[model samples]
Target chain A: MTAAKTNDPPPPPIKYDFLGALLSYLVPGLGQMTQGRFGKGILFFVSLYGLFFYGWLLGSKKNVYLPDYHSGETSIVSRLASDLYTRFQFVGQFPIGMAAWPAIYQYVVSVQGNEKPPLNGFMSSPSLEELNNLQRNGDKTWDLGWVYTVIAGVLNVLVIYDALAGAAFREVRATPGPLTPPNGGPSK
Target chain B: MTIYVHLPVLIVVVSLVYSATRYDSWNKILREALHWGVRMTSFLFMIGLVLYALSTFL
Candidate 1:
């Protein structure tokens, strides 16, 4: 008796979890953890947070900030120039959610001239004299700190992408060929 | 201390995070991370030596 030939079913399509991706954006490894990838999630959380805090400590919280264009300088050209030149590093730092808040708050307070913003370790604005001193001293530490913080922020973006996109390369299953019989018979 | 000391720490962290993202298995991740870390450190050392030589001669 001849064996009946049957076609194999197609593999299921890959499903992307948008909510998980969003959660990853909000908190670096939360999405992976939610998806039961506890080890990966924790690893991401620890590494990213460690780098961020270390950078912050190195920079003394001055590294992350939105550009401060002077008051009433609403010209689009000037804004673009400020962003491109003075605050470009912020483009990298903005990906870090909560850790970046102090800088954002400082920017808002500086622009709005809010009632003397309270002095805190993270948000304490350096006085003009201190700024001048930093400038005159040509402090390489400040530059290094800024670079470290920017790098940390940029690296978190990689973590977020990993959480959302799984491995860059995945192993795909080989499809069954017509020449190969399901019961292991050789092709005629 | 010179800022260059931070380079090794940065490389280690980057290698660990990068390897962790690529593999699900802890052992595989750690092995690959160490491999990458060594490779990066060696490459950086070579570049630093070349730069120092250039600076000294020029």
Candidate 2:
């Protein structure tokens, strides 16, 4: 009257891959290559960076930026809110990781309130007046250019997840050994 | 215009990036991307048609 016990292999252990995620965040598709997924890594890196740089080119290299200009708000919260409000586009651009760092660097230097900082203009923050001028003078293509950068950055968020989680549909196959289960062989 | 020229490229990139997240194999990812790219392009074209008709009528 007793039912027979069945043996089922345990699910594969899920590793918390901090470094992989970090690497992929810094450079798109890097984590996958580190994890031996070379093709995906290459695809990710080339595609993401291509899109990002193309957008940079479209915008004439002035798309990704955090403005040094901020209205004098009393609290840290207000200042933070003001920055976000002004640079809301940065939320999209920021996820591309270090590629977007120049903007932040520009802001830090700008805190000194320099009339003209001695730094390369790469992703540098423009003054509020300058930003307005750029917008007024430039056309719709400029808007689309930043949109490309934003899309590239946002897509990278997914890449980071994939780097940490490994492939979503990957089967956890035990190595071939005396005790290992024999159902499927190596992937094609 | 640059915007119109870039639409297909955007679709292809978006499809490839999204497909990469779903599967490990490059072959499967690329295949899925092709399918999704077509679907997305068609969807967008339909929406454009609808908007165009609305603008003309209204």
Candidate 3:
């Protein structure tokens, strides 16, 4: 009679890094690819890139270019200023300026050495100019950037949730220990 | 500028810089950076909404 043969137990589950998934949310697609989900990663990047492009276009049309410098007038160089300046006269200005210049001038200009954003909406002569800009392109037509920002914000939330879910999936499979009975029961 | 505007912009700048840095290893810092980015973006977006409301009414 031959002796009974023994076999090695199955390997434990693979664990995933939660931090990796969070990072993927920041970069969109990096985390998923790192976790070996190439298809998911590609999809993430596509969605992220698509919204980014749309946001950029909407922002550009609104004259809200992301400033290159944050310090001062010289500090705020813009990349699009070179290319789109002619097409959109205000291409390099921050998007907020569309709403800001008018309101600020109305409230703060009357006060001496005023530098603060207005606490309430104020109107002044220069506001007429800004309003004309708003109206020239049709009142409703130029307000689309707000819509873009809202949509992009929503998409980012979805991407973050997806990343978190992927991380949770990783956690479920991490350990490889045998399923020994908790009360020290005999192995099957 | 008002604190609301300044704070949101500062948050965004710090988050963006942190996210774009060169780091050799993955660490808790990266996770925190992402969290900060999400927070800052949310803050700015909220402020944007407030501005929208103010623009439309007051």
Candidate 4:
């Protein structure tokens, strides 16, 4: 009597949803929480809140300018006091201020000069004619703040997901599971 | 930098306490700890979603 030998295919690879994870990562706390990481997720969200408050405080002091095409000017809204600015700046990296990504992108692109012409209240530099033209045609500058905010929001979601998923995957891998024989064969 | 820096330390502290109380052996500890971690992480995930919505609307 001879025993038969059979080869079995390898188990299917564990599917890792990288994009889903990335979405979580863009946010402070998300993905892992979705998978059941409650503590970490809460911590991340709280951290985000702290950063936002800090930025809000800082943004309160100096003008956080958002160009308004309709008005044909840079609408420089007064921000918080200098004290608030200093306090917020100290923790700037965490909450990621309103201008966080915008500042970083601007720096990366090496935009030397200010987009809004340095002048008094919004569109002070532009003549009446130019202002009228911008208003009629549409102002890209005004939209920049909102656009950036949306981008940041989207990125935050991604980050949160990524963080949670990454941790979950790591935890899963680190924890061992029961072993089984290859080829669906029973171990004797 | 403010809260972010403190977070790692906080996570570690919580993990230690959780492992100490919730775990019996290495495997048990690891499993429980991970489960808790994931749970905590998920909570944050929901909060983040809420915040994102808040940011968008308000």
Best by TM-score: 2
Q: Which numbered prediction scores highest in DockQ against the true structure?
A: 2
Model 3 CAPRI quality: incorrect
Over 4 Å off, model 2: A1-10, A75-78, A128-130, A173-188
Q: Tens digit of lDDT per residue, candidate 3, span A1-188?
A: 99777554444564445765566545666666776766656655655545444443543333322222122233223433432343342221222122224432533343333444343433222234664676585544334543443344344444455555533222223457678887999867
As a TM-score, model 2 comes out at 0.84
Per-candidate TM-scores read 0.78, 0.84, 0.34, 0.29
Model 1 ranges with Cα > 4 A deviation: A1-12, A75-84, A119-121, A124-129, A135-139, A171-188
Give the candidates in order of DockQ, highest first.
Answer: 2, 1, 3, 4
Model 3's C-alpha root-mean-square deviation from the true structure amounts to: 17.0
A2, model 1: CA deviation in Å?
Answer: 32
Report the TM-score of chain B alone for all candidates: 0.91, 0.84, 0.55, 0.70
What residue pairs are clashing in model 3? A12-A176, A13-A173, A14-A173, A14-A174, A15-A174, A64-A95, A69-A75
Docking class for candidate 1: medium
**Looking at model 2 chain A, which ten-residue stretch has the lowest summed lDDT?**
A179-188
The alpha-carbon lDDT assigned to residue A184 of candidate 4 equals 75
> What TM-score would you report for chain A in candidate 4?
0.33
Each model's lDDT comes to 0.72, 0.84, 0.45, 0.42
What's the true lDDT of residue B37 in model 4? Answer: 71
